[model samples]
Target: MPWRDRISELPECLITKILSYLPTKHSVKTSVLSTRWKNLWLTVPSLLLNCHDFPYRQDEVILSFLDRLLEFDPDSRLLKVKVECGGSEDIDGLRDRISTVIQRGPQHLDVESFTEYRDDDDDNFLYPFIDYIPLSLYTSRTLVSLTLTYSGLQDPGLVYMPCLKSMTLVKVHFLHAADLEKLVSGCPALEDLTLIRNMNPIYADEKVMRVRSRSLKRFRVPFSHGKRCRSSVKYTLEIDAPVLERMTLGEDHYDIIMVKNLTSLFTVDLGIKFVVEFGVFFYPGDLPKRNEIRYFLSGISSVKHMIISDKTVKAFELYSNVGMIPKFNNLSRLEAVFPFKLLQFLPAFLECCPNLKHLILEVYYSREMEDAFELTDVPQCFLSTLECVQLKRIHEWEEEEMKVATYFLENAAVLKKLTLSLTNYPRYVSDEEIFEEVNKVTKRSPACHILPDWGLCE
Candidate 1:
């Protein structure tokens, strides 16, 4: 029997549904396959175009494709539109395309403008000069999720996005700090907000980054280690989210953080270097700034789960020395990354978390460490509430880790389980040997069981 082309006989809606998964460029190619698929790409519900997909003079090609795609069916149900534009001088063309997409009432829009090359040594390199986009983007009523990278946002006079639930701004230049504040305030349904400000010189100059939102739930300022602005000025992070649940703060420049009305905070992952000035260290002489850090800690003290970075542990160690550590009575699960040298101060840091039940310790290597501080008294959590302890991400096991394990096993009176996972161990020792050595440690709690884990065996 001859083939009857059963696939092409499927409903148009189903055909477009299948085409939506493929990029618009690839989807358009299927139009030549058969007459049934000729106009299917136009109503695919998604227009995902990338400048890299097209060869030489990519910007013009991208604009041309978008023009044809959008002009084909003005009322087509474009659920999402993602435009990844490589380094280009034609910013207006990209903005025009985005404006047209906004008019089509897309639910999701993601645009990323990547610079081709950046010369750190070149004094003329101004880091991709991108002008502000069209005002229609901010006024998008149908956009549920919007992600923009390496872009500039103009003065948001009257921002309003009623359905926007998630927004991510990566290195987006804002004319004024109030622009961000107004933009966030206008989004009534915004729940997830992320700001990647590693390359923003304006943020450092503004000195204050206020994130005030009532409906925001999960917020994050992802780790920007080596990617800080060249400006020497430090910034302040003022957060006033009444209903925020989870927040991740990862930056070194925002030394002074002011948080308020975070009543529903469940988890907080912290990693702040607290280097207020560019070249200045956070010395003990700086009492006012140090006190501000205390205020920031007390603001989120009610969080039930906290994942702290190794830098935060160092900050906590410094705060502990000056008696600036705040009590985290509500914190039940505490995960902290500590370097081998900082292991000595873990006990003192734990003293602040009196009700901590679970402890996840990830130890790494560091070259520079502060002078050792020894604590004579045991942490209150270790003696009472702490039950489960997991030692993970151990690149190399050393004597300091063993001492920490011994201390936890001997002091955690109610400890029920202790799991250890080793990765990239030294060529000399085996996992079995490390397990045997850890097993020899004395357990104060009779019910304690030691378990060894080989994480995700290759």
Candidate 2:
């Protein structure tokens, strides 16, 4: 058939919807495509602008674009708007543009590096210090999803975003606990929330952050890696979400944690970095910290799937030495990373996860790893419900590591599959040689099949 422009024949609203997905720069370029598409770009109802997408003078170019784009239809409601600029010198221009768009009623808004600046005195760190934001943003009636990076949030005297569902604040500063609490409280319909605090030395003071919401389902506080110089500045996090399904607490230490009404919580990522320095493992003397750890674990004892980091494993070992680790009778899937030395103590930790069905144990080496250890007793999961085990990240094919595999093979009566994912193999050892050695381990479950994975090696 002869060439036919079928797309152009679609309704003008449909064409505008298509243009909304393209970058504002690309959308404007469509003006030259045809007479019909010329003014159509102006009605896109979305602005997706990035400084790098333009030529030199990133700030000036974006500011100019925003000035004209908003001026074209200043009263129209924006469905989505994203403004990402790298320059900090002329950040006010970007913020003004953002504030202007917020008042125009945007459903989804994302602003990154909007206020990140560096001081000459502190050449070591780039401070994400935002002094103010449009109060209208927190009370946005049309906003459904909001993401602000490198920004500061002031207590917006009142917050009532009736339609907002998801919010992500990365390196965002809140004047105090009340500012965050106020912002979260205003979003009545928020379902997923992620708070990644700025690691600036300024926010090192002790503070309490409470999150209470009825509609929230997923919440996360990812670990922010910075100088442990302010490790002593502890935070007390309090959460009261009745229907929350998933939560991730990645801080190295929390002085006090209160998680309430997480009856619906199913999965948890416990990447708690026990307040301890590197190379020093024994914290037997810190009974208060031990109590804090036990208290936090007790709140989420019903989580079905759990992920434990290496630092947390050490904390578990320490707590296990002093007292009982919280029992997770409901946990079915468990993923944990352990140093070579902590392998012997795995049974002690697993004893609490009596109903675990799937286990992924990642073995690695650390300089601070203990020299001598003893496997006290076998866990109940190994003999009962445990069906699948994945021993991954195996760097050293040492005798003790092999014994760990044999320990599971000889104990997990219900195990159906055992996967060995190897990493960092010795130059002299062959793949067949390694597999042959593992195959020799006596299996307690006759139906269990052993599988070797070389993907990690590649």
Question: All candidates' lDDT scores?
Answer: 0.79, 0.79
Q: Write the per-residue lDDT of candidate 1 for residues 1-458, one digit (tens) a residue.
A: 99798879899889899888888889989989988788788889998887777877566666777788888877776898888774655545777777878888999998886443344566865444555667888888899999988777878788899999999988777777777889999999999999876344544345677899999999999876554434555566789999999999877646577899999999998877666665344776678867877888889989999999877777777767775688889999999998767777877788889999999988775535545534356899877899999988655566656766777777788888888877754545678777778777743345889887776322
Clash pairs for candidate 2: 252-273
In model 1, state the lDDT of residue 158.
84
RMSD of 1: 3.9
Best by TM-score: 1
Q: Write the per-residue lDDT of candidate 2 for residues 17-37, one digit (tens) a residue.
A: 998989888998988989988
Give the Å shift of residue 432 in candidate 1: 3.7
Where model 1 places Cα greater than 4 Å from the true spot, the runs are 1-6, 58-61, 113-129, 198-205, 224-230, 253-255, 278-281, 365-376, 395-398, 424-427, 442-444, 456-458
Output the worst ten-in-a-row residue range by lDDT, candidate 2: 197-206
Task: Give the C-alpha miss distance for residue 63 in model 1, angstroms.
Answer: 3.5
lDDT of 1 at 27: 92
